[model samples]
Target: MKVFLWNETGKEKEIMLEDDQITVPADKGKYIYEVLAEWKNGEISYTFVAEVQ
Candidate 1:
């Protein structure tokens, strides 16, 4: 699934969601979802969907 992320601190890269988990970079920072209806702002946000395994 596609995840919209905003650089809350105006820094850091938004990671893609995979295997039901959102991968984070080695460095730490803050960010929020660019899309509201699909996501929420928080340390960890998850979106679940069905796909070919």
Candidate 2:
């Protein structure tokens, strides 16, 4: 699985995971997180917003 983190400034990073957990540095604001799941036949992805205070 792969995880993507993006900020308002367009700064982003991609992290590869073996299991299903990852830690990322987040600033106080709104951010987006995208997760991709890879399969043998196909792949799927999902996106959500993260609000840091």
Candidate 3:
């Protein structure tokens, strides 16, 4: 599995996972994220947006 994050400026960055967990950025703003899961038979992807205050 892999995870990535993108800011409003379109800057993409890879997120590191610790024990299947991740820490969101502290800056207050909106962000986009993409998650990819792969298997021997197939693969899947997902995207979503989040807002932080």
- TM per candidate comes to 0.34, 0.68, 0.81
lDDT of 1 by residue, 1-53 (tens): 45654553642344566775665444444335432233355344453332222
Ranking by TM-score: 3, 2, 1
Better by lDDT, candidate 3 or 1: 3
lDDT of 3 by residue, 1-53 (tens): 98889766763888888998767778898778888899999999888887889
* Candidate 2 displacement at residue 42 in angstroms: 0.6
Q: State candidate 1's TM-score.
A: 0.34
Of candidates 3 and 2, the better by TM-score: 3
Ranking by lDDT: 3, 2, 1
In terms of lDDT, model 3 sits at 0.83
Better model by TM-score: candidate 1 vs candidate 2: 2
Badly placed stretches (over 4 Å) of model 2 are 8-11, 16-19, 24-26
List the candidate 1 regions with Cα displacement exceeding 4 Å: 8-15, 34-53
